[model samples]
Target: MRRLAASLATAVLAAVGAVAVVGQPAAAHGAEVFPGSRQYLCWEDAQTATGQLDPANPACADALAESGPNAYYNWFGNLDSNGAGRTEGYIPDGTICSGGDRGPYDFSAFNAPRTDWPTTHLTAGATYEFQHNNWAEHPGRFDVYVTKEGFDPTEPLGWADLELVGSVTDPPDTGGPGGDNYYYWDVTLPADRTGRHVVFTHWVRSDSTENFYSCSDVVFDGGDGEVTGIGDDAGTAEPPAACPDEAPGAPGDVTAHDVRATQAHVMWGVSQSGCVTGYDVLDAATGDVLAATDGSPMVDLTGLDPGSTYEVTVRSRNDHTGAVSDPTAPASFTTTTTTTTADNAAAAGACTATRTGASACS
Candidate 1:
């Protein structure tokens, strides 16, 4: 999920050659709690390790110790498949982060009542962009709640401890290939609340009984999205050394394929070390990252302006170590106007089928 920062110049759209643009047919997966979520913050900590699931933050390390690595691996999936709006008695206290025992994967350790967990800072009464990972995107409403004033993090969290603050249905998507994949919307925090609190999110899917949940730690300490407790030495005993980027070896045989008006294909040989976890394609003209891929040697570059000359380069990536290779020498390609025949237009307008045997579009 972690990659080098890219510019927001490309238009957002669904995956190419994949059916169902929204509400993906796959199982209802998890989301990111904008600012920060337990899983997300923990996932960020784990990426510092060169190999294995080594969390740089102490609390994150404790989470990994308590729950297995799968907690971070499946960070986007803290879901209960049949909650059906029964939250109070249905989900038990102290198990909010893991959604009780519903998971075939155990995330019970994430519910450990601790004040030292990673926290995102926010300004009260401020309208902020809230985002959630859209892994296998689903159509749903998000029920967001925050703990009451004077809520203690050391104590167990119960429904009584929270008050509903925000509710959004089918929020818009800030399309990108960042933070795994996510849904985005804006929400204003309560003006009267202050101090450390737990921001709970419940995603109710319209397609099925499957729902997702999260417990994001936050503080109203006048911070402008500056995170504490993980990277900084705020809670940990020993100050950890900054993680070094171990860039992968430069790729070979880089060539342009499938050049089109709005899209182009680029492929290259794998890194010699075979340690390359992914690839990032960057615009040579603008220096913005165009697209990224995990294992495929080829990537389809979209959102390009037609009749334009594009010089792009590819760089290998290692997600675990936060490392990226030097950009390959630029490969130039010119795109021509794409002609959309009646068949292509009709295909584009047709409702895409989903795994649940339903259409995602009207």
Candidate 2:
């Protein structure tokens, strides 16, 4: 029996609502941190000296404001420096900065909006994979930061909430003067970490100053036997269906033999199908449809003038879905020769005798 192939399908999930926080922040910390909380922070020096944080500013503020704290950033040109501090120390435009157009600084130049800080609902003990693909024209690399919500940018190492995992350089095949950059990090979710973790995909500029651009696409598979909703189903699309099953048909067994002087006998298996519409006999050499039958086997090749070889193949079609089966193996045969008697008339008319000559023909 022939096996048929089935179609392919995809499974999709639904989206969940934003998380809400209920408690107040401690006096030492500023605000209460909860799951799903999101915000932005910028280098203080860049904001003050470059006036980058003001929403009204055309270049710095506007560009920084549009980016989410969790978003990824891409620094322009080569601005290699060290450490994140005042903007002038990192940014090229900074007057106090010693590095050319770039300085070494920490979360000082630009940050996400304070109110719209991103909230992370990641659970501890679960593993997550962070992937980044940079198809940018120039060399681009980013750093991943998982910090606590509502952290101060001014304090040294204050933003180092939870280092789930980090990759500062571009992955292989993503670096160099050409080509895109790709990076990914796999980390086991912290058992102590829960509700509203701040996930940051920061672009590490040449200068120590870094900028945050986009948030990570969070996906929760399993952990602690607890099912916490995280991923969005509305955005997920189902995979397209697979190809339809092939139609069934009788195994094609065809045979051929020379007949008479210029004819040949061709025989093929009668097609049997639950949905067989028709069957076609094709000349294997020329691909021409020699004949079409509702569902019969066997055909005669006449008027061939003998001593000629021919090849034939057969195929069946499904009536319901219009699916056609592949052609069967070809069958080949040569026509037999014909002969007439001479005056001697002994056995001169025999096909073998005629070739032997008059004495044999006689």
- The candidate maximizing TM-score is 1
User: Residues 1-362, candidate 2, lDDT per residue (tens digit)?
Assistant: 11111111011000000110111000000100111111111111111111112222232343344532111111211123232422322333221111232321122233322322222334555555443432221123454546454433333222334363555454433232111223344544445543333454544433223232333212223222221221121121232232234474643677764243444445455443434445666778776666554432433343344456667787766545667777889987764565312111222222221111111100
What C-alpha lDDT, on a 0 to 100 scale, does residue 361 get in candidate 2? 9
Task: Tell me the deviation in Å of residue 15 in model 2.
Answer: 27
RMSD of each: 12.6, 29.9
**Top candidate when judged by lDDT against the true structure:** 1
Off by over 4 Å in 2: 1-110, 113-121, 136-143, 148-157, 160-181, 201-362
Tell me the tens digit of each residue's lDDT in model 1 across 1-362: 21212111111111111221222222245555476778767765565222234566677888888776556655665777676756888898888777886864567888878887788887777777777877555577898898999898889888889999888998876553233456777777887778999998888887667778888998987766767776544443343343345557666657775455544556565455424556666776666666665533445444445677878788877766867888888998886676333113223443433222112222
TM-scores of the models, in the order given: 0.60, 0.27
- Candidate 1 weakest ten by summed lDDT: 8-17
